[model samples]
Structures are given as structure tokens and as C-alpha cells.
Target: MSGGLIGLSGLIILFVLLIIRIPVAFAMFAVGFAGIWVLRDLNSAMSLLASESFTIASSAELVVVPLFILMGNVASVTGMSARLYDAAYAIVGQIRGGLALATVLGCAGFAALSGSSVASALTMGKVSMDQMNRFDYDNRLSTGVVAAGGTLGILIPPSTGFVIYAILTQQSIGRLFLAGILPGLLLLSMFMLTVVLLCWLMPGFGPRGPKSTMREKGRKMAGALPVLLVVILTIGGIYGGLFSPVEASAVGAGLVILIGVLEGRLGFARFWEAAKSSIVTSATVMLILISAHLINPFLALTHIPTLIGEYLSALDVAPMVVLGLILLTYLVLGCFLEGFAMLVLTMPIFFPVITQLGMDPIWFGVLVVLTLEMGLISPPVGVNVFVVKSVATDVPLGRIFAGVMPFWIAMLVTLAILVAFPQIALILPNTMIE
Candidate 1:
């Protein structure tokens, strides 16, 4: 069979495997290795697979993955997430829908520590759900906010999404991390606005909590200061040229461990559990990266990206129009696929077209990450929604999905603003030290 035909068939089989509950890494691996073997030879396939796995695993830059994951997990065990939530709640929890807003802020804070959306959602959900429940807040709004806010984990600085994108596109990881800051804060503000607007339209949905004393507020804020300091030092270190992204991850992880020990909240058992969890998450990411490397070569052998690029470039529409269509494809795909899966599956086809059109890669990275954030809260397979459901078992899945609708629209607005002013995503990266 022709290489194009084989590539097409391989892609179909890969998706079929995914739909049948196969892990994405294994599916990509099986299809990729097989495709390369057919197009080239068995020896070439085995050689590429072995080399790619080692190269990805041994790469010094990827140390950020487990380190940052460990930092977040340790923070969670040490009760830093709860302190952050309490601090946000103290600041905003008294207003209508304030608890929800606090939830978004808490998620943003947790996102800074943990780059994984699932971890952010699960951690913040456990921290904030009971408080929202305590105030007789609508379950839909409560669960929805946690699910939606959790997605910020991947758009914020130190995000795994940006790290993966940087590696795939060969862009600077530091610049990508910087590029995410403005867009991340923009989404956070928009999410808060959605909560406010929803409460205005129906105050009963999110009733206000009793105001805290100024002393109480100060205490909670003080309680959260340590983690806040870690966030600032790590991200600020990158922005100030004091640390590379990998270096920043190491420092952040180290500080979190130290704080846990000093506070006596992270026991040997807890620390070991955090390390084990980070290992599992990191291993999964590494396998996916290796599989992606194999698939990239197979796709090149088939000339699939070149074909798609030529076809896209030949269209009569403006480049921005083509970009819009590509994003729309992402929107449609988001409903079914997880964010990382979508990135690896589509970037090989789309990233080339993006560069061919002369768009900035960093801006495109932010845009794509935003779309991935949307997917996390989207229907049919909204991973964050399911995660929220897992934590708030009393709330039905449908309610959680319904609650996230407003925040989803808020994300759409944020995306439009970023597209209209690409500077929003590019400003920090453009000015960063080379």
C-alpha cells in the first residue's frame, strides 16, 4: 500500500483504539511503530523507538515535569491548597458568588504549583467544595466553577501544556512560560466575571457568606504566604533571567519540600506518596512524548503534514480565516478528546501550516493552550467535569456540566480577545531575555 494510504489507515486505527479505552501512549506507539515498520523496515522502527525513548527520558529539560508535579503534590499534602482557598475566600467569599470566585482564585494559585489540570481540579475541589456547600450555594455553580477553574492549571506559567508544546515546536520553554502569564490572568479574570454576572442574574445560585473579621482575613492570607512566595520566586526567577525553566522547577520543588518539613505537615509517608504520584504522572507523559516522536517521523515519511500544508496554503481565504477554521476543528475535537491527546494528534498537521502562514509560534501556542483549557470543561468528555463529579459525588454530572457553561463562555471571550490582540500572549515573551 502507498505511504499516504497506510498513514490514513494508521490514524483511523489509532482513533479506534482510543475510543475503545486504550491508553493514548500505547495506541500511538502501536500505530507509530507499525507504520514506520511498514514504510521503512523493522530494524529502523526498533532503532527509532529505542533511541527516542532514551532521548526523551534522559533529556535534562524534562526534569521539570516530575519536579513540578512533586511540588504541587507535596503542597497539597501539606495543606497549602486549603490555606490558599481560605485566603481567597477571606478576600472574596462574602459577596454574591464570592465562594465561586474564591474557587477560581484558589485554582489559579494551585495551578501555579501543579501544572496538571486534573491535579488542580482534584486538589481545589476537595478544598473549596465543602465551603460552597456550607453556604447553601447551588451545586451546579459550585461544581462547575471547580471544573472550569481547574483548567487554568495548564494555561498558567509552569504549565505542562506549554512545556510539551515548546518541546514539540522547538521553541524556548522559558519564553513559552512567560507567554502564558497574561493569557492565564486574563482567563482568571474572565472566569471571575462570569461568576459575578451569573450571581447578578440569579443571586440565589451563589449566596454570600458571612464576612470575616479583618484579623481573620490577615491570618488566612499569612497562612498562604509561603506558597505564594514559592510561586513568585519560581516564575519571577524565570522572567528575571535568574533561572531557566528547568532550574525554576527544581528550585520550586525544593522549596516546597523544605516548607513542608519546616511546617511538619509533610510526613515521610506523605512525602513518599507525593513522590510516587509524581513518578506515575511523569512516566505517563514520557511515554506519550516517545510515542509522539515516533508518530512524527511516520507522518513525515507519509508526507501527510506536507500534503495538508499544501492543501491549506492553496485555499483562497486569508491566513487568519484558515487559523479560525483550525481553531474550530479544535473546538469540535475538544468535546471528545483530552487536551494532550489533541495537541499531539493535531500539532504535526497544524503547526507546520501555522508557520507556513507566518504566524508567531508563541502566540499560536497560547491560543492552542486556551483551546485545550476549553476542552477540559467541554461536554461528552470534560475531564475536569468528571473530576469534579468524583469529588462532589452528591452533585450529578449533568449539573456540573451545566454550571460550567458560563465559565466556558467566559473562556470563549478570552480566546477572542487574545486572537484580536495577539500581543496579550506575546508581550512578555517578546521582551524576555534571550
Candidate 2:
């Protein structure tokens, strides 16, 4: 048959494999290699496989993946994440839904350090769940806050999501990092407002927390000062042109380790565990990226992206309408696929359409990452919801999903605001970078 038909069949088989619970990287590798062999030759397929694997595994840009993950893992092992929560609690825990608000702030802070949504959800859930429970907070609100707030990890600086998008689209990672700041904070504020409205409407959902004395607040803030400083240094260093993204990652990791050791928190055994975990996570990301490389060439050979771009360009609608449709597609697919898998699968097909419309790639990257965050909380395959469930095992799965609905709506609102004013995602990157 035609190349397009072969590509179409391969995609269907890939989706079937995913639905049957095959691992994402493996499924993509299988489909991509087989499609290349069918369209070209076995030797070509083998050559592409070996070369792609090596290229992705040794990529210089990807150094950030392991280092940033190690920083987060070490921070968790050393109780730095807990101290961040304590500082946020000291500031806001006395207000109505205060603990939930603190959880959002803590997630934002930790996201700046970790850049992994699973790590953010897992760490914050462990640190905040019992505290919220102690205050008689509703299980739904407590679990929902952790699940939704954790998404900040991908929108803040040092985000793996932005890194991968940059690699695939050939955009500037530093610009994408800067582009995300305002939008991330906007989403954080929307989450906090959602908590306030929920508590106001349903007073039993989140009760007011006990007040902290000024001295206690000061002590807690002081305890978290190291983490705050690390965040400012790493992200600020990137914006100030003092360090490239790779250097920032290394610096951030070194600083976290130094703090952990000096504070007598991270012992050799714990440090070893964190390093090992970072290696495993980094390996997984590398594999996905390698598989994506195979898939991109296979799709290019089929001319599918060209066809889709032509079809989109022929449409009479405004570019914003097309953008809306594209985002809506992401929202639907997110219910079925993991965020990175979705990014790897769709970027090759959709990114060209974005550029053809004369839109800004950096702004689009921020919007795409934000959509991925929504998918982390969306049902059926809400990865963040499952992460929260693993922490709060006694709570029913449906309840956690239900709790995230309000925050999910809040995300939709934030997405809308960014769409209305593209400057929200562009202002920093525009003025700061060039």
C-alpha cells in the first residue's frame, strides 16, 4: 500500500499495544522499527535503532534530567521538602483552607526544585496528608490538593516536559523555562483561589488551621531558607545568563547535596538511594526519547505531518480556533495516555502546524506543558491522581478523581487566560533572553 497507509496502520497498532498495557517506550520502538523495515530494509531499521539509541543516551542537553532528579530525590531524603511545607504552613496555615493553600505553595516551591510531577505529588502527599488530616480537613479536599498541586512540577523552571519539548522542536530551553514562570504562578494562584471558594461554599471541606506565633513562623522560614536560596540561584542563574541550562542543573544538584550533608540529613546510604533512583528515572526518559526519534523519522517518511499541515493551512478558520481545536485534542488524548508519551507522539505531527500559522513556539510549549499538567489530573489515566492514591491508600479512587475536578476546572481557566493574552507566557522570555 501507500506510505501514509502503512504509517496509519502502525499508529493503530501502537495505540492497541498501549491499550493492552504495553510499556510506552517498548511499543513505540516496536512500531517504529517494524515500520522502517517494512518501508525500507532490515539493515536500515537496525542502523537507525543503534544510532538513535546512542545519540539520545549521550545527549548533552539531557544531562539536566539525571541531575535535577537527583537534586529532588536528595532533597526528599534529607527532609528539605518537609521544611518547605513547614515554611508555607507557617505563612498561611491559619486561614480557612489554609493547609490546602500551603500545599499549593509548597508544591510550587518543590516544583522549582524537582521538575517532576510524580516527585512533587509523592513528596507533598507524604508531607501534607497527615497534617491536613490532623486538622480535620476533608479527605477529598486534601487528596485533591496534593493531586492537582503536584502538576506545577512540569510548568516551573527545570521542567523535564519543557526540556523534551525543546529537544523535539529545536526551541530554546532557556526561553521555554522563562516563558513558564508567569503562567505557572498564575495556575498556582488559581489553585489557591479554588481552595478558598471550595471552603467558602462547603465549610466542612477544609477547616481553618491553628495559628502560628511570629517566632515560630520566623524559625520555620529560616529552616526553609536553603531550599529557597537554591531555587533562586538555579533559575535565576539561567535567566541572568550566568549559567546554561546544563550548568544550572549541575549547580542545583551540588547545592542540594551540600546542604543535605551540612545539615546532617543525607547520609551515605540515603544519598546512594537517591542517586540510584535518579539513574533509573533518567534511563527511562532516555529510552522514551530514543524511541521518539525513531518514530519521527518513520512519520516523516510517510509524509503524514506534511499532509496534516496542508489540510490545516487550507482551512478557512482563524488561527486561534485551530489552536483551540488542537488543545482540545490534547485534553482528550490525555485521558488515555501519559504526558510524555503524548508529547512524543503528537509533537511531530502538530508542531509544524503550529509554526506554519506564524505562532510562537516558546508560547506553544508553555501551553502544551500546561495541558500535560491537566492530563496528570484527568480521569481514567490521571497519573497524578494515581500517585496521590498510592499515598492515601484508604481513600477510594473515585473520591480522589472527584476532588480534582474543581482544580481541573481551575486549570482550564488558567489555560484560557494564557490563550487570551499570549504575553503571559512570552513576557519573560522576550525581555530576559534577547
Global lDDT scores for all candidate models:
0.93, 0.95
The prediction achieving the highest lDDT against the true structure is 2
Clashes of each: 0, 0
TM-score of every model versus the real structure: 0.99, 0.99
lDDT of 1 by residue, 1-434 (tens): 89899989998998899888899899999999999999999999999999998999898989999999999999998999999999999999889999999999999999999998999999999988998899999998999999999999999989999999988988889988989999999999999989999899999999999899999999999999999999999999989989888999999999999999999998999999999999999999999999999998998999888899889988999999999999999999999887888899899899989998999999999999999999999999899999999999988888889999989999999999999999998888887755
How far in Å is the alpha carbon of 214 misplaced in model 1?
Answer: 0.7
Candidate 2: residue 434 lDDT (0-100): 86
RMSD of 2: 0.8
lDDT by residue for model 2 (1-434), tens: 99999999999999999889898999999999999999999999999999988888888999999999999999999999999999999999999999999999999999999999999999999999999999999999999999999999999888999999999999999999999999999999999999999999999999999999999999999999999999999999999999999999999999999999999998999999999999989988998999999988998899887898889777999999989988999999999998999999999888989999999999999999999999999999999999999999999999999999999999999999999999999999999988
Error of 1 at 369 (Å): 0.6
TM-score result, candidate 2: 0.99
